[model samples]
Target: MTTTQGLGELTAAERFRSRPLTRLQRIQRLLHKHPEISPLVVLVIASFAFQLASDRFLTASNMSLILQQVSIIGALAVGQTLVILTAGIDLSVGALMIFVSMVMGSLAGNVGLPGALALLVGFAIGMLAGLINGVLVAVVRLPPFITTLGTLSVFTALALLMSHGTSIQGDDLGSVLTFTSVPVAIGPFQLTVGVILMIAMYLALGYCLNWTSWGRHVYAVGSDEDASRLAGVRTRRVLLSVYVAAGLLVALSAWVLIGRNNAATTSAAVDANLDSITAVVIGGTSLFGGRGRLTGTFIGALTVGVFRNGLSLARVDVLYQTLAIGILIIAAVALDQWIRRTGAQR
Candidate 1:
């Protein structure tokens, strides 16, 4: 009887130990279920629908343009996805982007730094700003919304101070602008540096989130902080890492912006925080946090990009585009809630 009981106990322990799957398996399972199709698929459908709606949609010119336009915003959205995955939100990303951009432009143009070195400084500034936000929320225990909100105002003010509330021309920065202007082509199709940035970001983050131990910690922390802590996951560390990751991404986007337009403007990323949320939400990432994926963010970014490009091709007014995005963001949130409720019922 004692031997039988020991054998049964060992079997149960083994089962428990082997239960958890890697992040890739989790993503795969999600795709297999209804309502969790890769957000990228929705983006593709949206693109096709827009093409069908207008003659300009399928042209190589328009397609390349669409990809280019979404690059900077797409980069910002990358960070947003990371922070959101931890069941948190950062409302200051837009303002921080402005600050980082200002620093880059002013440093390289006025301060006489080399283009490459100036770019490095911009990323460092973004990381520092992000560190501030992370410390505020994770260490200081301030509410994520409130903490980021305060930083938003401060960062915006700082940006204004740095630029004297003026836009910086690309006059001194023309050398750097060439990087954004040059397009790499495959046969007849050309893609901008921005598009390449977005794609590279997607690949890197997807791997980190789906193939690494850090990704596991992010999911665990977001799913249930207290439980994750009890299970030996360092919840605070994960939160800090997520915020820092987001900030670094925002800085990377600053490069794309400089490269694309060759000018730096304070308003460039003003709507980024909202758009990032919209992209993540539309991508099928849960705003409430733990149940999101970067793949969804890519799709979400594409959806927005497609909507904007399609509307432009269809000759719709720009304000109407804003309204459509508003509606979509609200709808995505509602759908997330409904899904969670349904899952609970089951």
Candidate 2:
């Protein structure tokens, strides 16, 4: 009986080891193991294709322009990435940013507060807004989509009321508010301070996500909240912290927005909330949560900028540019679904 059992176990092991991965399975496994790889590939292909279509697309000036254009969306995506990683979404990001920018502008331009102090207050309010969202989702057990959707309307109304539907011009906002617009030359590329700041945020957030204990908890909570809670992870606290962190990033993005647009207006980046989500999705971060990288988000944002700029350079119609992006978004989500299935099968 013992000899028969041993032989059976050996055969089972051999069969398992002999199971071969098909080509599609191999691709799925590669993407499952490294979610960022697919987006990186897409970015490379898009860049090469655009460069081929328009020589200007590869020029240093145009490259710098793309980085500049993507800065606000990229920064917003950083916060969105954190929220989505926890299986949540923040439709209020753009509204919160505009609200914060309006407050910052009013404090400095109208209330006579110093720009730096106004910025600090804006940051505090941003965290407070995030805290409210966190409380609703983490403590009250409301769905993330619903909570953010409600806040989106609330924040938008508040912004309009605060600004009285007026824009704060960059001239009245003082140098401090617009400092991110300052240009810096590096060899052949001309990048703004806002672009550099956005890049720094990515590097810092990437390090934290990959190397820190809190980051691990974030992934755990997003992966399986019940399992993580059973494992002694503070799942609720992780969720709360993620929203607050997202808020802080949104506040920072407001500064970049002001610098980029040279104004604080409620009308600026009306599509930013969706744009951030698009960047996150295109970057290979699973909407179902807990499987993504900031690098992918960065690349995704750049890809959007590239597509618009490239299409324009190629003299494609504006509507076609948007259609191209829509297609990319759909493709990214489909790819994500396929990758998620791989994990389910395993």
Candidate 3:
């Protein structure tokens, strides 16, 4: 009886040790290692759930609409992602975008300048705004949150002042308003140039962040500024570069906004700053900084679009949609905290 018991115990131990990981377990392990993967999984599950609720949810036209709807937010989120990757935030991004649009409208629509030249001027102005923010953070040593918060008010006021609390809308917008109307066919779907631009920008940014030395410096600074400085990273320069790049992205987003909305209004995209941050956080970038993926941000933006569209199709009230987004933001923050704790333990 003792011999039989020993053999049985040995067999149980072997079985326990040799048990192959289940698919769910494998996925959990993958998510644990790469937190960004979690958002993508959520996106898939959300899409599946929505599709089941409404047969039209998965249609090609709706898919195209989702891309179109997200194009502007995705563009803004690109800049926000860079800032967050550096452990910084830019509350002024939306304001800067709107300001640039107003400047573009004023120059092209009212001043009678060529639309192309006006676009260039808008870009330059946007970069200047970014440069100011960078100087405050990198040189003046101001906290990013404080700097951007102050600038947010300034930019918003400037946008209102520039447009005189009015919107610029007319035939005077010329090709500037119509440029983004160009469409390309993709299999069963059609998407505007703005959507294409958003995708292209993300691709370029992904390459830069994944393959460049500058990108490494960005991560280094975000991870630990003092340590990065000690390790020969030009922390100030990196911060400045990041801010400037974000500003430029904001400007590009402004141009797309003009195309999409066909007007530059002070009131447009009022919540863009918060929305961009939401996308970044939901995409799995820790607000504490130093960890995130560009692809994740893209997925996050799409995820937002999916939620709104899905919820709308289900006839959920708009107020409820907003509540859902708020819930998502809270859940994402919780997930970030959990990931950080687990990482610390590991």
RMSD of each: 6.0, 2.7, 6.1
- Candidate 3 error regions (>4 Å): 1-29
The best-first sequence of candidates by lDDT reads 2, 3, 1
Q: What are the models' TM-scores?
A: 0.87, 0.96, 0.91
Across residues 129-225, which tens digit of lDDT does each residue of candidate 1 receive? 8889999988998989899989999999999988987777787775763366568886566887667877898899989998999998997888888
Better of 1 and 2 by lDDT: 2
Clash count (model 3, backbone only): 0
| Ranking according to TM-score, highest score first | 2, 3, 1
Query: All candidates' lDDT scores?
Result: 0.79, 0.92, 0.88
Best by TM-score: 2
Candidates 1 and 3, the one with greater lDDT:
3
For model 3, how does the per-residue alpha-carbon lDDT over 140-254 read when each residue is reduced to its tens digit? 9999999999999999999998889988874677786547757889899999988988998899888999899999999899999999999999999999999999999999999
The window of 10 residues in a row where model 1 has the poorest summed lDDT is 1-10
* Residue 273 displacement in candidate 1 (angstroms): 2.1
